[model samples]
Target: MSKATSPVRFKAKLLRPAKPANAAWTFLLVPKAASAKLPSRGQVGVEGTLEGASFSAVLEPDGQGSHWLKVDNKLREAAAVDAGDTVALEVTPSGTMPEPTVPAELRKALAAAPEANAVWADITPAARHDWIAWITSAKREDTRTRRIANACDMLATGKRRVCCFDRSGMYGKGLSAPEAM
Candidate 1:
């Protein structure tokens, strides 16, 4: 359900990653009470503005059980937001995450591995997104191919996700697809 900005809005200083373990620079303050009225962090489908820049994002739970939004580099640039700046944030439940696109190779691999395909169908959209992100994050053609192959192997054997994917976006210390060199 869509919501007006007023009720869901808050002003908080952007914060840096708190420690070595928290590597993502993100918004420091979230209206925790208001967020409870929205979807859970796991299903953070929300459309809102950061300092007036419009974006779609997910709010996920942190170790302390509070919701946090990761403002990626692109969003920070577009909004001119930086760590330590106080900015207005408006978040409303956008529902579920947009489905991640499966690479053609991953699709082909899944087709050849019926077991993986079956498991794929049973997973939540978020779980599927994890696999897709891991596969698509690969910058090199060969790397992407390997991730796809690995995805099939894991899924075929009933693995819900690639082991150690930093799905939390925390320190990003997981099985992330290699970025372009």
Candidate 2:
């Protein structure tokens, strides 16, 4: 739903990756019940309040038919909460597709291929987002690299969308929220 009449509200405990983790990412598991109100079981663009602090984020699918929000360091600081803290969240679908960030490797590949870059520039943000999602959903580095190459190849040939990608994770099991601590 675009600009929901009432925001979906929930409370979830922030969790960190198990010890020995290399990154500083934190997460909040959106309740399955709350996630059902979201527009897609896939990546959803949301504008929300976390512990009363305003923010926007893209919720990622949790692989078991739910979703999770990746709480970055900035939001955690602004919200003044940390791992192990249960906090309130109020969110509504952002009303527009959020632009996906391009990974470095893919950006480099696109830059080196003029035809692909032109096609990439011509595609809609949603199309670009799908390409990014498909590439990043690869669990293995080799698979990611291959997907990037394939994406560029397809783009160079003027393909506007990623073919056969299950953005919602309903058909393919390729995407999932990272393992929680």
Candidate 3:
């Protein structure tokens, strides 16, 4: 894996959701221009600094051809910032794609289906990531259950990639970063 030529730097105001009065996260939007410079429009691993506090994170697609950074309590405390503050951000896509975590439901389904499990084990990390993303992107429980079943069926049939999955959320509005109020 190789590093990007240079880090993409930008500044964005941190914002918190209003509806979920108990929302635990604050986030900042990456400018479209800066986001376009990253390796992928989808979820991308980035190692960078937020207000001089070094960190690594996965930038989530905003479903509008850009990305957003989730700022948790730890990072906020480290950076000494809060919602409504504009912060400096410099990020470069990680040299390697971080392995995406397999959702428990998918894991159980895969384990029960040996054919799909074999195919799942044989696929590349990126392919697996796409499959997992496609499954977890579902907005409803029923949809998610259906996707898992469909995924197993597809995998059992030797399908290596999720068909018509919009990883970047550019064409399909299936994935997006959480909205900030």
Measured with C-alpha atoms, the lDDT of residue 140 in candidate 3 is 93
Candidate 1 residues 1-181, lDDT tens each? Answer: 4433343777777777644454555555466566556644333567888888998875654433345667777888889978878888877666567665677888789999999999998888788877876676565889888888888888989999777765544454332211211
Worst 10 residues of 1 by lDDT: 172-181
Q: Model 1 — TM-score against the truth?
A: 0.56
Q: What tens-digit string does per-residue lDDT give for candidate 2 at 78-99? A: 9999999999999998866677
lDDT of 3: 0.87
lDDT of the candidates, in the order given? 0.68, 0.87, 0.87
The residue ranges of model 1 lying beyond 4 angstroms of the native Cα positions read: 1-7, 18-25, 100-114, 121-124, 129-154, 157-181
Ranking by lDDT: 2, 3, 1
lDDT string for model 3 (22-89, tens) is 98879988998888888787888889999999888878888998898889899989999999999998
- Candidate 3, after superposition: displacement of residue 174 in Å? 0.8
- After superposition, the stretches of candidate 3 with alpha carbons farther than 4 Å from their true spots are 1-4, 18-21
In terms of lDDT, the poorest run of 10 residues in model 2 is 1-10
